[model samples]
Target: MTPALLKVQGLRVAFGDKEVVHGIDFDIAPGEKLALVGESGSGKTVTALSLLRLVQNADISGTARFEHDKAGAAARDLLSLPERTLRGIRGKEIAMIFQEPMTALNALYAVGDQIAEVLELHQGLSAQAAHEAAVQLLADTGIPEPARRARAFPHQLSGGQRQRAMIAMALACKPRLLLADEPTTALDVTVRGQILDLLADLQRQHGMAVLLITHDLNLVRRFADRVAVMENGHLVEHGPVATVFGAPRHPYTRRLIDSRPTRDVAPVPVDPAALPVVAASGLRVIYPVPRPGIKGWFTKGEFVAVQGADFRIAPGQTLGVVGESGSGKSTLALAALGLLKHQGQLDVAGRQWAAGGASDRGLRRLMQVVFQDPFSSLSPRMTVEQIVGEGLTVHAPELDVRARRARSLAALADVGLTEDQFPALLERYPHEFSGGQRQRLAIARALIVEPKLLVLDEPTSALDVTIQKQVLGLLQRLQRERGLSYLLITHDVEVIRAMAHQVIVMKDGAILESGPVGRVLDAPVHPYTQKLVAAAAT
Candidate 1:
């Protein structure tokens, strides 16, 4: 058997007095794909970082030995390597593709320049040679118009494009190992498939070992040869991917797999007698593009984010817009909530709302939105009470300060948070809360308005399976009790099966299929819809 390329034993990482990762062990064979699966705060990222000695201002203890393929010499302890020696190994021997490509790439530099930097630093390539190599790498990663895109800044490219650029940069130096963290998290299903296929092809061609960090069990099952499950800072199980997923030993692992939304589980029936909350028709949003000419002119592109889309939700039903990223799922929600410019007819109960109008009191009172990233949506400087009560103060100024405070606390309780927890949390900022708690707080903020319709945009994407299940249950219970309507936008097919009464499959800003959840999900007609379902199932 070929010897392992990297082996880690008893890895522990700590931040000050708190130890986050409690002794984990794993190994990566040459050209093998290994996955670390866990929920947020489970130390998956920390473990990957520990491999590179990148954990800043933290105490890390472990033995990470690297054995070169060509030489049968003694294995080198990576942790004991001097700074200069480790630097030589970092990008030259091992490279990492970070989760958030936007933040990972330098905003100020062109994408080509970033890739060029890696090539120049490691390979000592000249400027022109590096630039040419950068374009070639981009092309190799399946990015179209590589030359033009290479000159574009990170912010100018789409999410998938940015991810491809990151991959290009990482592979430019021809490293022996690749560490990828949620590499396809925000991508659409088609792009995700392409990225995965690309990774597999590259791994085979280059014979490089891969250490993948992700929460998507389906992806792990499909791509990884070996799997390691982590929980509460410990590696609970590790084995072949099929063995671990097919016959999970740990309770946490079993729960994670079972928590995924599936067609077998029936959605709770919602009452139809509740008030008509939100209704929209023929919604279309077009963005202006700059014309390529000397004259200062802009041309309107017919990129309809929500093209002639129509839907209605009673106060108690969840109309799930199921699609990949950039499929106009979020665009539909934004249009209905008057958050973006659109040509559409929208009515909240009896009141008509002007598309993208700012002075629609009825729209504001009738509908509220829960954004995907609670950390960015919630003000980091504001306390929880202030964040939750801000809408109350704006809409119902008649309510005094004390009344608002009481209302905020009540709202917190409605979402399973308590006032006792509030004393510290209320005084603290959003960064202080865990991802699940932050989402709960976001839900509380939306619930405080007591609106008839709530637009939830991928609210559970960042959460663990167990936390997602609880949140979905909470939404269902709230809908039954308070008669709330939900316009749920998500890419998780299981979420649609479990929570949606109706499902609309979208692609390229158009609806490809729409029907009752059971009919569309179980018997999808459109090829795109079928592809999405198939991709999700694996």
Candidate 2:
């Protein structure tokens, strides 16, 4: 049998006096796929970064031996390699695709140039030759209009296109091993599947191994041959994917396997005469796009983000909008929040928004929104008190400072945060808290206004599985306590099933199906809905 392509023995990663990745061991064979599964802060990313010595000032001690077939290139210790030698091997033989492609890529340069840079650096290709190769690579990754896209800057491409560009760069050199760190975590479900399939196809063609670092179990089931479960700093379980998932030996492994979101509660009937928290009829949202130089002066083109739509969210009920990226879910949320202009009728609490009037101000207090990615959504410079109380200032400017503080504290308490646990709760800034805590702070910020309807746009998409569960539970409790309404916008079918009573499946800014969660999820009639469910379940 062929020997392992890469072997890690007693790997440890440390920063100053703290050790985060304890001694761990694993191996990857040629043309193999191994998934490193764990929650946030579980040492998964650090472990992968340590291998390539990419962690800044991180003290990594381990024997990461890479096996090569060339002369004098038999097993060599990558951990002990000098800086220059490691740089030579980084993109040429061992490549890495970071989690966020947007930030990973250079904003100043076009994506094609980025790929050409790698080719020129490793293969010593000429300027023209590299340009040709780069365009080819883009085409290989399934990006349309390769030459045109290659000329486009990183920001010009969509999320999926940018990710595809990143993949094209990573595989430009035909590396022996690829380390993908949550490659699809930020992408939509359909795009995630496409990226995974692309990786699998590329791996087979290049005959390279993959070390995938992610918390997504479905990706592991579909892609990996072996799985390694990490908890805190330890490798709790390591074995074949089927074995580990079918009969996990470690308690942590079992918990991880069983962590998929489950239905929490059934919908209780509401009064027939009661009005919906939010209502939309024939909702159409259109944006003006730039036309070509000649046509620009005559007429601007229009991009319809949301087609004519109709839906109603009963008070105390969750209306879930599930779809891929660019689907009208977010657009619908924006329309419902009165942030964007729409053609059709949309009312909040039986009232239509009157732009910048007393009615609009009152509606703002009635309906608030919680955006995705708490870390970025929350202002870094603002203290907890200021962040939560800022809404109060806009809604109830007449209130005194002390009254606002009391209300803010009460709102924080409702979301399970208190001054008792965090003495500097009011004074502490966003950077001081963890991801989950930051989300809680966001929730408190939203609740401080006493909103009747909350437009939650992918609330738990950025959180870990366990943290997501906790946040969902907190939201559920808040709904029960306040009889609040929620417009949950997300791509995760599991989250929709768990939290939503009514579900709407959307594609290309159009609703494919809408009904009770169980009916749509369990027995989806539309092909798109069925595809989504199948992709999620596997």
The number of the candidate with the highest TM-score is: 2
In model 2, the Cα lDDT at residue 509 comes to: 90
lDDT of each: 0.86, 0.92
- Candidate 1 residue runs with Cα over 4 Å from true position: 262-275, 294-303, 354-359, 420-425
Across residues 278-317, which tens digit of lDDT does each residue of candidate 2 receive? 8889999999998989989899999999999899999899
Clashes of 2: 0
Per-residue CA lDDT of candidate 1, range 185-236, in tens? 8776667888999999998988999999999887898799999999989999
- Which model scores highest in lDDT? 2
Candidate 2: C-alpha lDDT: 0.92
